[model samples]
Target chain A: MRPMPGNAAERGYALSEVSCDALLREFRKDFRIFAPVRLEGRGRFSDTDMVRYGEIRNFREMELREKSLFSPKEVLFPPSETLFHFAETGVREPSLLREDGKGLLVLLRACDIAGVDRLDAIFLGNGPEKDPYYEARRKRVVFALIECGPLGASRSGSFGSCFCVSMGTNRASGYALVLRPEDDGLSLFLEDPAFAAYLPPDAVRTSYAPSFPLEDPFPVRVPDPGDMSRAVREESLFSAAFWKDYDSRCIACGRCNTVCPTCSCFTTYDVTYEENASAGERRRVWAGCHVDRFTDMAGGHRFREKYGARMRFKTMHKIHDFHLRFGRHMCVGCGRCDDACPEYISFAACIDRVSRVVDAAASTGGDDHDAR
Target chain B: MPRDIVRKKITKNAYRITSKRAETCLRVRVPGGHLDACLLDVVRSIAERFGDGTVHLTTRQGFEIPGIPWERMAEVNKAVRPLLEALEVPLGVTFVDLDGGYPGAGTRNISACIGNRVCPFANYDTTALAGRIEAAVFPHDFHVKIAVTGCPNDCIKAHMQDFGIIGQAMVEQDASRCIGCEACAKNCLKRVTGAISMKNNRAVRDPRRCIGCGECVLVCPTGAWSRDPRKYFRMVILGRTGKKNPRMAATFLEWADEEVVLTVLRNCYAFIDAHIDRSLPKEHLGYIVDRAGWPAFREAVLQGVSLDPPLRVAETLEFSGYFYERDRVFR
Candidate 1:
């Protein structure tokens, strides 16, 4: 079920109100459940009260939010994943990595679940080669969507820069359950009967809400996908002056790419042992368009030498370019990038500024609008 | 208890060298984002001799010497000890982690912007203040993030840090020194704040409207406007981005003096000591504050600390994030 306003078909799911602690306790007995957990101190990325995905050890620790600062994608696609390990000779097969035998359960928001679907498209479906590592992690997991309300400190559902409604990712399906806030705890709605076995044996069931709030409380709209593509075209924006001012403002911190749930780019390297050069491991780590070495190639020709060019590439990929190639837009409109940016660069604001430039350029018929 | 148990303390110590196996990167502290040319040679020599040839310029205004082998940590430490002395970093007395490896995973490297020493928008000396803070807070096994910026423009992003210190200046206008240049008024009206206006061939400043960014001081040609010798700061607390919620920090102190700020910092330590759970590996001070409730936290942090007049403390901190009220998870 979606939020309120429009009737959200429960489909085949059974909704029941129960205590959050109780729900988590029951789930923990059977599966490895991941939830939003507060860090004890400075985490890997930042020093804020950043929440990250961790195993739910305590029933009370399973907290929900409007959105997490970082995505739960780390559970499926880690910041670093070792593809294989090699020994002696040139290339020996990779050593086996440990895997949790039991299935996994994750509590996610609507946009994040949609982000999972977008990732699934690239790694699991309609691709030339399916990633076995990603598939292994993805196939064994279950998802439960959290319906966001006007819950203070629970600002995970709607973001000021969010455009999920416009992108048609506001409502999430294909999950095992959908949770809505009841008086003190949560109303656990079960979609897949297989997951119901994890609920308390004596638990009685209720029905999910017929509707959910379709539009974001505060939505920032982007231009038509086709128009956005044209606006970001080489001919139109190559010489546009709007993106030139970021040289001083942007420090290329790579915070945008780290916080984005849809970003799936990775850079791989071989880590050979000093004692035995023959024994090495191939590791895949996270990489993004904002970092300095993102475009560096073997011949020393960097495609995006300028910061603005890199910013343009990132923006186009997020809003227009990726959507053009893939049937669905890569961005889930979660708006984590805006919150995570230290320079306070708003990707949503870029669309507004770029749209005006595109309109002006279209009207003037290639007239230069350099304000620099 | 010996710290460094779960994972390597590299991330907490501002060292990120996961790209290479068995190699640790050391994030050399550069207070206020400025360093002497002499220190560069020291860093370069160490990098070339002990580690890889490349040194990364971290976004936090520091240097990261990557590719240092794990075994040469002590040698690297000895070579770089003099550079730390020049930077006035507290060595043997405090923050002496990294003997065998970076073991302590608490206080991060202090970050600051170039203040009045360079930038026109600055109000106070940011680098000097960052050094003082590092002296007071570093080497502890408690997680804290502090950043100092010269003005409200917030180049260093003071608001997002665990302890944010933003500089502010009180401006005074001397009518006798006014030459009617109108430069101060012009800048105030356009770029900065329109807190000053030309009246009767002399400049009059509106104290309430001024943001104290020192725009008037920079524009004054005849020394008509000057900054007050007294230093002022605004302290913001508890802003964080995490799994459950992400919210900017709320102001705890406005127009506070040096003593009040120091006392508060001291009390933060005391409060953490009193309330930190023994079972958990570590606990963020912000989370501790949330779990302890605002009343207990406010009283503990402000115990015996007197605030200067007109410097108000927040009566009710309007935190916009979620925490577990039904149960505590640290155990």
Candidate 2:
């Protein structure tokens, strides 16, 4: 893979300028562009001004200023997707939806790309199961990187629970194209020469500058493994006040999971048509761990009976368990959960509290060490 | 066609699903979780015309109709127009413009504990109060959650809500008419908060510890410790759970009356309107308040509101019971 813009070699790295309108028209020839667009009212993401990834008609409709309220991952893994059509006789996969055309996802920020990487790890990596649905959709997606607000020392570079700089997810690689708006116009970084033929003859040369700074622009601290591993793995941290407190506070509304880019947990169901019992469809819909029935299993045993326990499991997985296997934190620190939660539960703040409590326990000679 | 309707998870009023192929689910917002039983037919119409003739009861005590096609959302909304119109509230009337679609789901349906209307331990009628609040705040585009519980038994889980309101009845004991039954003292110690005790054959309240839950007032058969005529509620602020720190709301106002609560709530909108970050997609009220320090927020919410004894605001709120400002170590 090529080094990110500033560090990459100039040869074959032709930086140019393209108006957003012309770029959208050019990209439409090759792939269907899914960009962030504002809806008339509260869309699926539920906020009035929410920006969500959707198939766009014009570049003017694209919302690029703020982070997408809903993740672009849905382009690959839909909220509710039909797996196949079934019948009394036999089952068969539905006609491939991608037959319309390949999809081009544009303006994905650093944390979002990181989110996609995590999704790839869970869905398409060297895992026991490779999701054919996600794999098929993922194969046709053309990734395009978009730079966030103009680089400046005056601002935090991130807003509202966003801590990508501290989470080490402020930068990403592996994109077919990069769009960074400058004082003049939208600067286009064309790394792949394969797309050079699509560019206009007037495309100008420009050098890429690092946006904001690679380091944290604010005081926000990222979750640390040191605070978690010792107290979470070695000690019974479940008994802490953190886990017990959320029982009443978490209403199990499941908005947090729906807004979360990394929350990939899903539940599959079969629905037979009423008109024709012989014909049916097996579908997978987004399921939230925070939901009370999410833990119900065979024989009536529930893994996470209480909301607090469910919250603990979710927090531990995002900050600890996933990291133990992937060597990286699962959370991209987008803070959409904070914006989405009606109860005002701040997942970003929970990471900090969990770290503090765990680190405190680690330093204070935890009780019942003999058991650990 | 509405230009930006992607017809994904939900439309304005309908929840779009992909089960058995694409479908739309209609959500019914019954304020205070209490609606006219006759409205069932409006639901029947929606279920028959737009849905698969089935309704799903939501945990929040509302109703959801399943299996309407995504394209038929407008028709579904049109069918439910009567039900939405029947609400008769100015907010509800304006909200019905979406035809029957949930008009900009900013204000959530208020959930309340059945109070003095039925329950014996209630300090006040929760359903009535929730309806009052719902009318005052609905159809707005600011995200604020309010839950009302009758007494400290907290069956409604008030502490978890953004603006958790628990009814409180200030106990005024008259020693002259004491029965010396020690009922108030015994109940206070056994079931209620230990804020009362028997002293000289009279129930004496520890003013400092009294959460004003009114258990003593309820058990006082001799009427020595009757509730003060003024209705009051304890207000908790901010509570939330998220990526960093999750916290139960801190007590903001005690012995607050309906006027104070309403004023504070209305003022909250003013504060939010003034401070919300337009650059971001959306901002939580708590986040906006956090940006403006608690003191500034306090001033903003309590601008014209007045308070007296038993209704005094904490000099400095220290939410030690759970997480908030001080609980988290991270930024």
Candidate 3:
């Protein structure tokens, strides 16, 4: 609960001297240091020691300019890993041990800070499968958030849907390390002044306003409270034509769910080698709503068959149902979905489309638009 | 998220308590007709006696008790194994085959878009292909993802998939219905061609220039412009436009013939299952074919057709439909 670095009492290195090397020296001591080191032209976050930090002298060099090519969700919840290992011996009950914990990941984006919060809500917010491995890493790490400034060029197309600015996730809070460029050097702010005192003068001190302004035109609106109950009456939603058309462009790729900030669905995999099925660990990895086998059981009855039904369930749950329970919209608008979607099936755009449809229905009929 | 809270209300009886090491898992399917309370009790009792009393919900609409001790895990199998044998649930391969459950096997590979033509974005029907493949292919435990895109916007993450089928323009159009509004030209993300010029109130289209993203069809009003009938409903396969193991789904087949596509898919599934070990994660069909040799496997499985040496994979396909991009201004 100490003040961030750059207070009158404790001043870190001068802005210029706080080169990548200096920062690495400070970071590598304990934390598994991560920073927005440049990769090719675009910026990618990686282990701090792996890249040349000298290339990152000031904030300009730091790729805090735009959304990092990837979200830091994996830092806490990886794509795949064994939660525990299970094997049987003769007559004894099979013994299971928890996975080892790798502590502290240093991610530098403001949006990712909020993204971590969202992930926490999903994984640890009272579910039966509150992954202990995820919890261990999550609790151990501190978020080092660098604010955004200007735009950088991207390798991929489909940027139209990535409007993280509208999600109010464009800044960092809680335990944060802020950097601001100054004439003398830079000012650094840390949550702990004692920790800040170790640094030389001229560190960076930075500040950020909420990216998603209240006046922003595309504020995410929560669906009607009774939309679920009323949706049943709106039988048009259940129509075959509606579903086919809506899901016509679906590629069944799990990218949206994979890149999303809050998607927590996963499947347990029992990976065995040719030599030893007994030695392989029991792994749980991220899964998505879009994937068809996500619901397939021993038998072939798919619960969310019909492309449209999957589309509708994923969309409606994000706005109407999730908000009703979580007290907030599930989406932080990372725009990853927009970028990740090969078909550009932007959920945000879909929400807007559905909203307009309901609004039109409401205007025509006295009662609320049937959500079904 | 609210429903998740409701879904989180796991009844004490619904869980099977067991250790984590159990090699086998007990999957249970609860139908709408069954009494929820009774099922919960039976499931919970089974968990208490055999499992560790904890149930994990699968993405595929079933629940499993992870970490069951290897010794007792075999016993856990007995509980649901009988139910699977009974005609009661109609278990497909395993027990708890809930209708509408997530089909993780072949579904992970193929690109089946929603019937979005019914809503707004669809250029073709996706469900028909999904159903056809589901019936024809006897897929082993393989994960293949397929994407169905109706238009150019590609809203369904089609590009980032192993198999992607995007809608394309079918034909050259008549200018009389064009309206010279620039709707079609402006809406086309790829800039299909300079043929459809609004300045002259007349437009000419280059059929070769179109990749069939279907943007022009969606924007065109008065139906002057249309997709080529021959090209409509064309199917492309075997592209892995994904981040992890990036590979393109090869277009070894075309047309929307559900049965024919099924034959090819069944063959593909057999080849993959036979050649590639399921132990190794199979990212794309092209990769598997490349490593294991496609011609040899194809000849082994596909007896009738003489195999071609040079593989001309279809990168794109065309489709026809009444298309409409959601007009932000009007809405």
Candidate 4:
């Protein structure tokens, strides 16, 4: 069911801290819950900590204040997944289900929920044949939407790099549960009727409505997908002088791709065991357009050698190309790429630049060369 | 009339007799080369009031106020009490008289590079370690020089000192997180030792060639390579610069934890006291180590110190320096 703010009173329930723990304990029997957790001293630098998604045992382990350095896409689409194992006889698919046959319950923010929809478009609805490896995991996954309130005591309207409101992804629906941290306990909106049975009988009925962030500290103007598509067809945006600056700036570290929730590109390879050369497993690993050798062919030839070309390819794919095929822009504007770029390249600024270029080209009757 | 200045007492008080007959210079010690900005007012007032209104930044990361009259040494010592209390007293250095200025000047100021507090390349806080070293070895007349560098880059010129403490990072990789991007491998090959190589779509590090510079950890995009929480250090010993011989230090200990480094450094003083040539007014630590062979020196310093499994002690030291004797240099 699509949960709306007006009808939240009909579905909302308040649970004490102990009751919430009890409810999670009950849910744990059938679902493996994943949420952002703090990993001490696991950051890129020394004496630093990073928050990333991991299988959480209880609510106390979840890091709710800060945005996770990585997205929850790894739960449904892992970094490396083995499709099947092959030997002299025949091929056998790896067991896709968990040992307990438990489903996946992910706690994420609204923008990431939107990001999951984009991933769905690519993996499940991109072409005639669905990706079997992704489908098996996708079918078992559900979401718990975490309320994006004023971030800690500082009450910063949004994370500095996020522009989810500008991209119209600040609000999301179709979550099994909606959780808001209250002073005494937790106020939950049980949107999916199936989840109400899992709640403790002691849960108190309450009138509560979760609010979505309407503004961001950093906002971007996303170009109209139709205008971007037309610009792509005319080849104006591809050859725009704006992309040349990235040649010197970007280090091609692929951090942006690895952190992106919607980036779904992968490359398949076969690995043979050292002991038995004939016994091997076919695996698919996440690939990024910015990384080296992404477009390498059989010969020595490669595409997008200059970092600028790779930036252009990624920008068009995120804003224009995928929108043409899927009826929605692939980017959810979570701005994780901005946060993760070591070179400090801002994807939000790039989107604004694309909007300017597209507007300039349209205003000049599609003959603008100095649009940048 | 000529001034009746007691040179030994004045020198011990951190006063330098300058070329001018009656003028002297006061050297202020700044451990770790890091100090509060408020302490600069004391230095500025002292220079303006006592000296020729000028201050020299010493090579050892200390402040040297020149052109001070020798007769005003007493007043200058009183003026510098604040500096002493701020920089030295807090580091556990005990002062006989807080108003008497520096108790000893033979051991130079412990210099350090901008460490993990500022530089991304640094593995640990060099300034903090330098302060600890200062606390352990200061207030003595050893005529020894020591420097701490954040990494193997040796930015503080630690190789030119009697004792050089270099930061080391124990880098480890998580194979599952690696995407075979080769960023770390490429950076290591180009800028550092080629310790990492890509094999089977993952980085395989050769620990033998790894200098523990942490370039792999710095350049990694996926954070597959990270520094171990426990800090380690590489100690290079007996490098010196003088008219007799000047050479870079060689590695004496590798993968030494903080306790081992501190104990070894503290024990070096006793080794020097036992073997120093008393005929001369003062002897550098390097010359004493040269007079006594490396084995004797090693034995003396390693007394009561336990070497952990990961710590590697040097089996032998081969010093590369030139003798100033004409017979040895003549072709």
Candidate 5:
């Protein structure tokens, strides 16, 4: 149903009461609740049975304010799922198949929210009918927006962070429990006044003031899709020197795919029981595009083998090629690729660097100026 | 007409104009520009005016319009000349399957993961290696799917491709960090060989017992651990656990180069190209290898290498090399 302010059709609640009873009850019915928690000396989103409301004392207690340490893509599209159950005879049927009308609830920072929206455009809107399995999980949930307050110290991260401000995803308005703490305790702003009445005095500070963008002007601009093909072709002229540096630092963890909201690729397997060889489950799990084995079809003919070439595929798909084919950038600038990277390969920075090279090359008009 | 390649539906704005009476299919793409929208409309209008009112989406992410007769090819090309320039989309010999054969499964052939640079389970830089392989090998007509995963978790399913590589960690567990917590002992599915008996309820891993899946590393609460920076990757050949005779692939090589990997892949492809009849329809690589005899063919095609004992003599009809052709890169 289309969202409407509470009146005859719907109603609002105070943020505190939403957190106290209503929110927890509503959340528990569907979601396996998750919030930021300290685990093994670091903070992360993990499942805990400690509180009925799945406690988040304040925004500070929330996991990384910059963006989620992990992307919520796993909530719907897990690392691995059973594609179907099978027997040795080649006959099979679905096992643990998720129903089509399920939903999920995620506490998302603005960047990831944007990422999900981008994913919606790719997976649900433009392409085929949303994958029935993915759609079942996607349609079931809602988003709870959390505003990022400030950057942390040791900021080894890039100055041109994939900030929500630049990505046009700094704030959310669909279904939120905005927090503002005052004297009584913590004040929660809710949609329903009845939910609001249950709040302790001065517990929640309610204000309509919206946070301003962290920096004045958004620094990044998407490279035009029209210029991509020639730019990519030109990039191939450069030798392996440029690629070797990036490859040296790479650790093939596949986290960037996991954290990316729009990375919808997957792989499948037919898992069978040991004793009951007649029965096994077929599983489909998320697969990354940046792996050595990803392109080896039959007979060992690998299509893309150079580090530079793989980088070319990723950047082009995100900015150029995908846009040409699907009319949208595959990336939403969530910056998870930057943060999740231990060696700290920033996708945004990479794009920015490549775009400069492309622009310079384009201006030269295909002349071999550097290497004679 | 092949029923497999029949007219499923007719959509507009996908392909260039087609003739009203041709047996073979002709696909034309509009160039890339703002005029793409306009060209889409123009192409759609033309298709309706001359032939059918629909276009087909191919696995390579291109569009095709059928019902074109051979005689009208020149006329069709002539009619769409202006629009082609404006659109900037090129049309040529397009393979029906380019990406993963299943779009629902994701990008195929040259698939790469984000890698350990960002992931918790990473043993090494899978992205770098995957990228290295993608660029160096130089592709052939038949797409070869290569997969790379950073750790034993096998997140990318590297073991399932024609050629696959998975990163493994060299690690040692400190006894002092052992809290007797059964988490590591319990979480391990491989039943790693190295583990000190549980004491004070905490279990310690014997360096020898670890298969290096890192499940214990992930679950361990005590910070008592040392991991080597030099995580090694194991190369796996021919592993597709899919329909039509699924099988688990075996390890082929270990500790090879970015260059060595490329050399082996190129040589293998050259072998397949030389031996397999391109004119005939071939379902998979294993099928050809099975029919052709593995040892004799390997001797002829992959001349330089010392053939692994298991691969050379394994009797399983489906060799590990030719699995499934999922994405644009067929495997």
Candidate 6:
């Protein structure tokens, strides 16, 4: 095992399943705990089940075996949010603030914690004005990092389409707590001192430093960020023929964007009540670049008309464009997009394809010509 | 030497009279067209040992082993006991004697299409439903043919049976989850009935046009469409292929539940018994229903059945088929 990083051993505590449940009950009083939960018979097909993020009150409710179909982003950024209500007198913003001022304790994997960091870049650090809606939820959230697997023996392939190691998102550091599921119970490493009060009084102390997966079971080759940036600067990758195949293959269902960990796009619209014409609410719903009407302007003009062009725009935003400004790629490689896609389009494979194009361009002396 | 053998008794005992004198064929009833692969060895052993080493896969999903001598009928009956015990006994089919093979062959094998266990389009398990029907009305001397199809596609040729139980999925749509991709709508328009259409960037399904094929549920990327867990069925009645009035089945019950289907099937036997011509050696179910007329047939079968609001009972049925006497029109 790797050495515990900086006093991690001092914070480690071993709790039996019984005590862990007790600790969860105590946490539930002040914080709404969210974790991946197995919803029976709620899958796309009949007699099937799906695992997604939901509110959980007990440790046993958490589904640790399978990777969630959707990322933990939904807890902070809901699918639909009513911005403000309009009336003859004035407009009033809905109070999304919790009544008890309770915080959100989310249990997620290391890759998802990294995904949240990328989301932070988009919502909070992108420009001068931070999104207030996202800031409201972000300020009251703390993470409990769930161990994906043992060091050097990750179950990434079992998770299907995961390539976090290649994207350098297999490890995370900002989480307040680390939960390692053991055969008998749970081994928790708490970073935040305040959270330690919630632990059971009789909880046994142990030397359990959380281990990050060293390698992905399903590994993909990712191009160097610098090489990707150079390819983008040349403007050759944008018009490359690699995206043309997706015109027919991709149905533009936007399922990839829906399940993406870092996709932060939203479209706002007003809904008027039937009884009162002017009295209704303004709502913001999650939108995707691949979806229709995502780029609609005032004059009925739109961008990325073709499905392949949308794919190109999304790929560049996730890998090259975001990195140019933020010093890192937007994708954390959780691979939920790869999982949720009904058309079986692999975003990881697309990244690898981008890597190949970058290498081909580099081999040809970095010319301005199209890589394809 | 020619032997004096009683033909009627042996025919009822699941043995067929072949053209070759003193030779017979043994009919093995495989309910729902599904069986344990290991049980095939029993069929193989009987063919190789007692009869000519050839097995005919019957249209009603059964095995007919030919070239067995009439004298060895007892042995064949003894050999087929294992099949009866395995396939019949577990399905709640009561047997008087374990050694006695199929007591009656007038009610043919309950056939079914491969269902949701494998096929994506199938709403429910057809084989299990077939088995359930077999348990309800089997071991009887009534000439009836029944088939179960997974969807409206009718891969099992259910339209040609006396009773066809076609599976239907009651789909529910969540507009909030819909991304207006039009995948389901376009697919429904091109392949299935044009039941779905885009309205204000959301899919609007017409219940009247929808056949409950579950194609929308299969194609929806955002899971806007889903099958209601409660299974519903559409039953078509009195279709047959014969010398007299061979006709395709017509709709009798739509959006019926499992209990309704099984009850109707059970009620059909009484309807057949009350109207069958006793003088004839055997009468097909369609001819009996035709003789009794549609109203009398419907009244008899729906005696105790409680028709729910959504469930529609056909007021009339017009069968489409050709007659042997209609050869003059063909000329």
Question: Of the candidates shown, which would achieve the greatest TM-score relative to the real structure?
Answer: 4
Off by over 4 Å in 6: A1-7, A10-20, A97-100, A151-157, A180-187, A201-208, A232-242, A292-306, A366-372, B19-22, B174-176, B193-210, B308-312, B317-331
Residues A42-140 of candidate 4 have per-residue lDDT tens digits of: 676666677889998876777766788889998888887788999999998877843336888999989899998998898889779887777888888
TM-scores vs. true structure, each candidate: 0.50, 0.50, 0.45, 0.93, 0.46, 0.88
lDDT of 5 at B46: 46
> Per-residue lDDT for A25-74 in model 3, tens only?
55555456554554431111101111111223333455443444446676
Real interface contacts reproduced by model 3, as a fraction: 0.00
TM-score between model 5 and native = 0.46
Give lDDT per model, in order. 0.69, 0.69, 0.49, 0.86, 0.50, 0.84
TM-score per model (chain B)? 0.79, 0.85, 0.53, 0.97, 0.52, 0.96
Docking class of 2: incorrect
- Against the true structure, candidate 6 reaches a TM-score of 0.88
Question: Per-residue error at B265 for model 3, in Å?
Answer: 41
What's model 5's lDDT at A293?
57
Instruction: DockQ winner between 4 and 6, please give it.
Output: 4
lDDT of 3: 0.49
Per-prediction DockQ comes to: 0.01, 0.01, 0.01, 0.57, 0.01, 0.38
lDDT for model 4, please. 0.86
The docking quality of candidate 1, as DockQ, is 0.01
lDDT of 6 by residue, B37-75 (tens): 999999999999999999999998999999998888888
In model 2, what is the error at residue B99, expressed in angstroms? 44
Model 6: per-residue Cα lDDT at residue A15: 88
Comparing candidate 1 with candidate 3, which one achieves the higher TM-score? 1
Give the Å error, residue B227, model 5. Answer: 13
